[model samples]
Target: MSHVFPRHTRQAPPVAVAGDGCYLIDASGKRYLDGSGGAAVSCLGHSDSAIIEAIKTQVDSLAFAHTGFFTSEPAEKLADLLVANAPDGLDRVYLVSGGSEATEAAIKLARQYWVEKGRPEKGRLIARKQSYHGNTIGALSAGGNEWRRAQFGPLLLDVSHIAPCYEYRERAETETAEEYGLRAAQALEDEILRLGPDTVMAFMAEPVVGATAGALTPAPGYFKRIREICDKYDVLLILDEVMCGMGRTGSLFACEQDGIAPDIACIAKGLGAGYQPIGAMLCTAEIYAAIEAGSGFFQHGHTYIGHPTAAAAGHAVVSAILERGLVPRVREQGDKLAARLTERFGQHPHVGDLRGRGLFRGIELVADRDTKAPFDPARGVAGKIKKAAFEAGLICYPMSGTIDGKTGDHVLLAPPFIIEDAQIDELVDKLDTAIAAAV
Candidate 1:
């Protein structure tokens, strides 16, 4: 029996002893290729000398200073770097220790912004079905996953959930992809109108729906329409990219690919590349000004809001990603990865779809490919696939409940930005074997 409480009480997982590039070696010396970057977190791979050195260097100088007292160089430099390349009008960074904390801060900040602007009634949050933001109570309340929220239902605050932009499942057979995109995007407007628009505070979603729905990407013009609705209603748009941002989706910010920017965005996972714990909530200049001019302060603070060593790791990671041109490489290799996956599984009897953007991709598995019918959840297909993948020495992010949080299964692949062509082949090969065995 282990004293450290593992995530799943019934099963104690393999002990990860070391990580070399995209592979993690367990205590037993089994090497598993990190095909999903540990749930799309590690973009620069597990071992990067520069990032490691940056963390050590910052720690040697300064580790932590209370945000209320002093500001650190690494934090200042990171904020500057992020704002310089952030989506349009986003001028400030509110750093946090992890994804859940970042989201909690974003939700509270959105409320505070409205309060400062004298729109205190705007407190309702709108999210989408099959979407995930984080696990904190606030973020959990904002999420739409039934399985996650069912037990905590009594504790979770009321929030609205609309249809997700899931083309393969939600799109009507006769509708064109673009029309389906438009129709899906229209849900927000309908929901807002039903709720009497002004009562709503923020509309939050993942640019590429991660974790909960197996890397579901929005259809063309979907986010464009979403932007229009949010603009018309004056509802703050919060893109929760904790699992999909920071160049995992080919661009520095996934919103860049969608061609629309959010009023506020939460980013983590790849920002520190696993070298340190760091997440950030970045916001538009107008939003920042609302609070700055009203109360002269944003009424939120965490002890580790801006730790120096973690900030140094984040700054170095972001700087290296842009300076070394890893973003373009992610895009290019992502195309090749998609092509290879399609070639391998596009026609498989159990494979229904291969979709996603950049290095982030998903392979939805089905019992019947023609109808795109999901395997019964009782079968536990996703869990079986994961076990098989691990047995085969491959680490892929596979999740069930791809549809309505219960029935569907998908395998998500988010390899490191530094992944090579040969590594892609190895990834696919292992996945192919795993899927075959699992089925």
Candidate 2:
């Protein structure tokens, strides 16, 4: 009987005692490869002495300080580092505890920015189906995951959700990739026109859709069209890069590959590299100026906002990523990872699609390759694959509902930036066995 409640009540998971590089060791001395970086969080892997020392130093110097009164050195330094490396026009940063908090803050901040600009009527948010922002009410409303928003629908805000850019399942057979990309992106324009652009506050989408839709990357010129649509309507563009950003996609920011800059961006997971619980919301100068010039305060604050210890960890983790040239390393190694996955799964009957960018990859599981039909949700394919991989001493992120909220399945692979070539081979081998057993 454990007093600490777990994510799953009936089954108590393993007690991880230690982390070394890309492996987590259970108390029983069993080691498991961290193929998904623990939900794409640990980019620096485990046992980073620099980040560990930074956290300890900050704890000793100043553990906690309310942002209402004082801002600590670590917090400021972290913000500066993030801003310096962030996308163009993104000038200010707001620190939060986790990805969800960062997303909620970005949503509310976007709304408040419009209010400050005397456009309070622009409060409606638009997002895409098969997308995920966060779990909080506002964030959940922005998210389009059906299972997550099912019963809670009544409590959620009336945010409109359009189609996602999932080429494997959503693209028509006759359409070219570019044509599919344009058609998929055009959905946003259609929705905006139907809703009246002035009433729409912002359009949010993940650069590479994570969690709910696996690691779905947009097609060529997809984002450019979306950017044009937003600009045409004076609607704000908010890219939720919480999962695929911070070098997960082989670039510092995943949007860099799309060749567009968002009005506001929410990034996490890789930001602190699991060294600490940290997330950040960054905005353009225009958005910041609206709040700075009017009322002069962004109405938001979490108890742990700008926490010195988390900030110190974030600073150290980010510095370690840049200083060690990990970003380029991801690009180089990610190519190998993708090549290996393609070679292994490209012909596998159950593997409907093997796609993604950089370390963040997705393997779509299907019942029939010809039709791309998903396995029955009742089959529990995702959970079974997860358990099988764990038994084989591998830890990969397997998710269901890759197509709709209840239909498809996919395995999301996000091994640490420090993962070795040998480990990559071991991961694919173990995954091969796991998928065999699950299907």
Which sections of candidate 2 miss by over 4 Å?
none
Across 1-439, the per-residue lDDT of candidate 2 in tens digits comes to 7899888888879899999999999999999999999999989888888989999988988999999999999999999999999889999999999999999999999899999999999988999998999999999999998988999989999999999998987788899999999999999999999999889999999999988877899999999999999999989999999999999998899999999999999998998999899999999999999999999999998999999999999999889889999999998889999999989999999999988999999999999998888999999999999999999999999988878788899999999999999999999999999999999
Angstrom error at residue 132, model 2: 0.8
lDDT of each: 0.93, 0.93
TM-scores for all candidates: the values are 0.99, 0.99
* Prediction 1 TM-score vs. true: 0.99
Off by over 4 Å in 1: none
How many residue pairs clash per model? 0, 0
lDDT score of model 2?
0.93
Supply the TM-score for candidate 2: 0.99
